[model samples]
Target chain A: TQLLEQSPQFLSIQEGENLTVYCNSSSVFSSLQWYRQEPGEGPVLLVTVVTGGEVKKLKRLTFQFGDARKDSSLHITAAQPGDTGLYLCAGDSYGNKLVFGAGTILRVKS
Target chain B: SQTIHQWPATLVQPVGSPLSLECTVEGTSNPNLYWYRQAAGRGLQLLFYSVGIGQISSEVPQNLSASRPQDRQFILSSKKLLLSDSGFYLCAWSPPRKLQETQYFGPGTRLLVL
Candidate 1:
């Protein structure tokens, strides 16, 4: 089974604080995706990384895929209260399946 | 533009009752459909996925089953409800025939079994 291990399962920070969540795996994947989920709602896709060592940014969020294709990270700069949510990392296994991590719950207090 | 819908939005059922959750996609054809379960604001647990109609892949087998009756419709059913089955059920879709791509999720159904 392909597993993506995510760290800092729970995080709490004040507004304007920075945080980084990591997703690691022993198995290589073709692509990695980041998602943010709110309470009582399905997760919303945030970003997808297809290239090794690739870096993509979306406003205050930065996503990076490891060169080995076995890891990824999501960094949030100057986090606000709206940024508080569950951050999930999913890896596209081989063909049609995706392996998901446990996810990181972030709480940014104002 | 693509949209996915799942209903009923929330459910409350007694144990041993039958369960059926429906998911449908619009503005997209021949899309890949997936069913996932989340434990109260936690990570997702993939239950099943379908590449096409009548083709379902089971990831974690138990009492749950899935079916794709049309290109854009997917259903999750169980003969008997379990207390452990209560959670946030999510449905997602992605473009077909892609090696790797992003998936769009629906609003989700919250199920609670007594």
Candidate 2:
């Protein structure tokens, strides 16, 4: 059973386009993190949002934590081919384990 | 300034064979460690976590077990490998400050059980 759900399991777009991915859950979380993974590498931390209604940005990526702490969103601006990879959002519920969403595989054609 | 490392970037093991994977953390002490498995085309599943030496919390009952013998060391071992164990194993750590901490992951070990 997946604790978190991500929308648009697969996305393909041309360069310069914009897209948004979402992660939703019924349970509340203390903090949420966004990660990007390449073809053969582990997921790299992008940004973290701790407070409800928090928003953080890293370069072309923007992250938002829902006020209720049960959802999050990641938006990419002017997407590039280099951004093609898997995007994952994980939530920490008060322990060592991080519950991850199903992930969104994005493909940007140059 | 913390780093996490996992051994055997890629492994090919036969079924029914014993398996062992090791993870180590540097530049931090008494950190919270975690073990996660990602099947092909699937999301990560938390297997176990540890808060301190000799402390383990398992989230799933599987053929695998984890141990933390040292403050900076965590190990995942299996008495007998199963084909279902073929997946990407990731090791992560976060400071023990809060439950909502952001965990950093290692490069991960890709295990292929034949």
Candidate 3:
């Protein structure tokens, strides 16, 4: 079973458009993280949210951890072509393990 | 500052051939190390993890195995490679004893087993 479920496995948008990707799970996590991966490269950590109902913003990107700690959302404002990549959400399963969602592939056309 | 490295960025092997992929982390000690496989540009499937030397945990049962011979080195090995073993293998590490789980990933090794 997929511990975490991410919506909109693939998305394509025009530059300046806004978009959001979601990660949900029935099990509560100790923490959640967002990562962006370019083709042929390792995924890079974008942000981490630990507390319930915590919201974090990095430039035009926004991340929110659900109040119950079982869900997270990543929103991008005025999306740019440079933002095209695979966006993945991972939940901390403790014991230094993580459960990951299938990830969302976003393509922004300029 | 710590950096993770994976060698032979890409590999192509035949069935029944032996396989070995190495990962090493520099500038850290006693890190929480992990091995993951990614397919179709999607989520990571945790294959194995280790918290210390000579200690390895397998998350999935398969033809592969892992070993940690040194504090900062982790190796994934298989006696006979299978065609199903074709995929991108990734290595990652997190700070020691931190529960928050912010992991840093190394450039992956793409293995194509024929």
Model 2 chain B — which ten-residue stretch has the worst lDDT? B94-103
Q: Lowest summed-lDDT stretch of 10 residues in model 2 chain A?
A: A90-99
- Tens-place lDDT per residue, model 2, A1-110, is 33999988999999999999999999998888889988657888898899999999889988999999999999999999999999999988865357899899999999
- DockQ of every candidate structure: 0.73, 0.62, 0.68
Q: Candidate 3 — what's its lDDT?
A: 0.93
Best by DockQ: 1
Per-residue lDDT tens digits for candidate 3, residues A1-110, read: 43999999999999999999999999888899999999889999999999999999999999999999999999999999999999999998655478899999999999
Worst window of 10 by summed lDDT in candidate 1 chain B: B95-104
CA error at residue B107 for candidate 1, angstroms: 0.7
Across B1-114, the per-residue lDDT of candidate 2 in tens digits comes to 888999989999999999999999999989989898987755788899888999998998999999999999999999999999999999998887544478888999999999
lDDT of residue A20 for candidate 1: 97
lDDT of 1 by residue, B78-112 (tens): 99999999999999999987635788899999999
Where does model 1 exceed 4 Å of error?
none
The collision pairs in model 2 are none
Error of 1 at B102 (Å): 1.2
- Share of native interface contacts recovered by each model: 0.78, 0.59, 0.71
Docking quality tier of model 1: medium
